[model samples]
Target chain A: MHFMTALKAAWRQRDSLLCVGLDPDPAKLPAHLAGQPEAIFEFCREIVDATADLACCFKPQIAYFAAQRAEDQLEALIEHIHRRHPEVPVILDAKRGDIGSTAEQYAIEAFERYGADAITVSPYMGRDSVEPYFAYPDKGVILLCRTSNAGGSDLQFLDVGGPAGQERLFERVARLVAEEWNTGGNCGLVVGATFPDEIARVRQLTGDLPLLVPGIGAQGGDIEATVKAGCSADGSGLMISSSRAILYASRGEDFAEAARRVATATRDAINVHRPT
Target chain B: MHFMTALKAAWRQRDSLLCVGLDPDPAKLPAHLAGQPEAIFEFCREIVDATADLACCFKPQIAYFAAQRAEDQLEALIEHIHRRHPEVPVILDAKRGDIGSTAEQYAIEAFERYGADAITVSPYMGRDSVEPYFAYPDKGVILLCRTSNAGGSDLQFLDVGGPAGQERLFERVARLVAEEWNTGGNCGLVVGATFPDEIARVRQLTGDLPLLVPGIGAQGGDIEATVKAGCSADGSGLMISSSRAILYASRGEDFAEAARRVATATRDAINVHRPT
Candidate 1:
């Protein structure tokens, strides 16, 4: 199935909009898993197993694994997720951007090597950097629109020429992604949950296209506001991501159980404001 | 040594501004070393040995290694570059951008794990994304400004707020990067060899800060115009990068020798425009 189609089905089947981020930090690993062989993969696999039922998707940030020379383990973890939870789609959050064949290589890395259902890309390099990824018809491409960081305002808020105050760089990105880049209907935008107003604006600009709304957990995004500002006409479409809070819920042995409890609460909280 | 200091030294010592890009594609690899165990590393090592003296720095685009599941080869290649040819700095052409710990992880991946002297980054995420890398006082961060791709004009040339023609998105990025992001002076920008006018504009905005100019050979960039527009006041601050033309110069055993011939000619061509 196409990533978007699979994502929508997963949202319905899982009854959640939460995207559990698997950014395994060795420094924060549980005592039992610390210093063990393939701890990065083990910790993440357990977290995936625990929260797979509560999540619409899983986002594995590639930098975490690549930093430790654990690309092999990353491959294993993604395979494990696919085998254990066939319904959940995985978003490999590498935020990659390049031109021509380089972008093709990265697409191959995400879809072929790691087997991610969808991947996030930085659109700063323009259309060519993104078009190469669209070659994968079944995969989804999420462009960073308004990121969940304070420094995002540095350039994303610059008034790139458009109607009065309506065409900041982020909004321009949203419009472009909706109008031009989504030709295959497999493209999406990343509107951070911290900026609910921007999220609402992005949703207004791009109809029911899926928005990967990252923030919420340790990033302090208001879940209720995020749900109301986001969500499609059908009261779905946003993959609300939470990482540190759920992953390291307890530094002790029952970390996976604690993760499930947190994921359950977060998924329930989002549903309260979801209106469906 | 600081990356800028090392690059300036490399420019003077090597008497060249060329940055040979190692974008090794399996389909493009030579017949003699096509399916060998470490073909990527072996090919890149040969190219580095052949062209190391003629070039100031070497750029290995990570996607090439990661796509073929040859990241270990990539690690080995960078190590070999440092060990064999200690004079030439290595630029990890990953173009990575993220925020907070995620950004830090990428920094570790480039500077610590892979051991690159410098790395390219996308400035779309603003300060926070680039700041993590700056934490390493020795390494360098080169932000994407005006890219070489034709699609770069898609968003880069949009009229972002500023003095009339001086505020296109790319120009705005140049101004912001020059004004604020270089606080520690460990920063630079990537202005493509394709657009010499924008390269001149970026040079004007960012005084003597180095520019990593890609797109000279296979991308059809004009080398004379690139050198004329991109040179620092001292006429030796740009790292003009060429990939396919130099890497796959020949598809036979003479590939390494042909690569050196191209490197020598390209380097001499750039030096003809150098002031001193």
Candidate 2:
């Protein structure tokens, strides 16, 4: 299935715009699962079971798994999600970019090895670096546009002269990806929810292209403002992701129940402002 | 030891500017090592042993290893290099960038887990994304500037209006890294040898800062022109890397010896235009 089709089906079935980030940091794992060999997988599994129905997608940041040398566990988590909750898409937040052959290798790693439904990619190397990920038409390629970080303005906000006249670097990227690079129709932009005004502007630039808005909840992004600015006319095409906020709602044994509570609240919060 | 110090030491001891890229494709492995679990490591081990004396550094592209789920092998290779060829620094060409916390994980994965002396990073998300890698003052963070691929011009060549008047996007990145971002003196720029003009321009822009020049050999980069345009006045500050040409010089049982021959020729070719 095409990424957009899968995404829409997920959004419809779950009645959600929420994308829960499954970043299982070893230091933050629950006390019970602390010393276990499969801590990462087990933590993610419980979270998936608890919030699978409330989330439109589950984003597993690859860095956390890679840091602990638990890539095998990451693969298992993705497989578990696929087997148990097939409706929810898995976005592997890898943010990887490279030239040609290397980029192809990364695509294989994300799509084939890890079995992620979608993966984030960096666009710093321009089109060729990002094109390889687009080869999987069934998967989504979420390119980093305006990040939520404080230093995001350092290079992203530069005024670059382009075919579309003088626009901020991020705006130019939005225009390019929306106009020229969306040939595959599997492209998406990662515009942080922390910057709602930028999100609105990017929405204007990209039209109907899906936006994966991070920085909500843990990053303190205004949920109503993000939903208002990021949503499409049909009240879809937006993925409001929250990682730390839901994952560690309560570090105790009720972590799964707490995560479900936050996930449901986040999904409802996004829907309240989403266009009807 | 600081990355520059280690790099200079390696350059001096090896008396070469060539950075042999250890990207072992499983399909390309020798017949004897075809189905072996340690094929990737053994292939790289032989290649490293053959070309270690002729090259200044070894850059193992992480994607290739990650594709095969051989990160353990990658770690073993880095350890092997450190044990046997202690002088040659290993630059893990990851091109990784993300938000602060995730970037920290990537930093640990590169510097702590893999023990790479340097790692390549993407500067798309700006300062904070690349800052984590800089925390290790001893390791190097080589940022992508002008890439070698065909679509490199897509966004990188945009005419961005910056503090220094109207400069291309890559130039702005060059200026940013050279002028303000290199406070730790552990930063380098990746300027592809395919674009000698950009290399020269970047050389002029970033004085004294080292350049990691790829696109040599199989990428059809002119070695002499690259050396002439990329090298600093004292003829150092440049790491000319070639991967495919050296690794696949001969696919037969003499692959190791063929690799060494090509590596030596590449080093010699790079030295012809070096400032004496």
List model 1 lDDT by residue over B1-276, tens digit each. 788888989999988999999999999999999879989899999999999999999999999999999989999999999999988899999999998889999999999999999999999998987899989988989999999998899888988768764378888888888898889887889998989999999999889989999989989899999999989988888999998999999999999999999999999898888777
Give a tens-digit lDDT track for model 2, residues A21-44: 988888888899999999999999
Candidate 2 lDDT by residue in tens digits, B1-276: 787998998778777889999899887887888899998999999999999998889999999999999999999999999999998999999999999999999999999999999999988999888988888989999999999877888889988776657799899899999999999999999999999999999999999889999998777889888998988987888999999999988888899999999998889988888999
RMSD per prediction, one decimal?
Answer: 1.0, 1.0
- Which pairs clash in model 2? none
Candidate 1 stretches greater than 4 Å from native: A163-166, B163-166
TM-score of each: 0.99, 0.99
The CAPRI quality class of candidate 2 comes to high
Looking at chain B only, the TM-scores across the models are 0.98, 0.98
lDDT of each: 0.92, 0.90
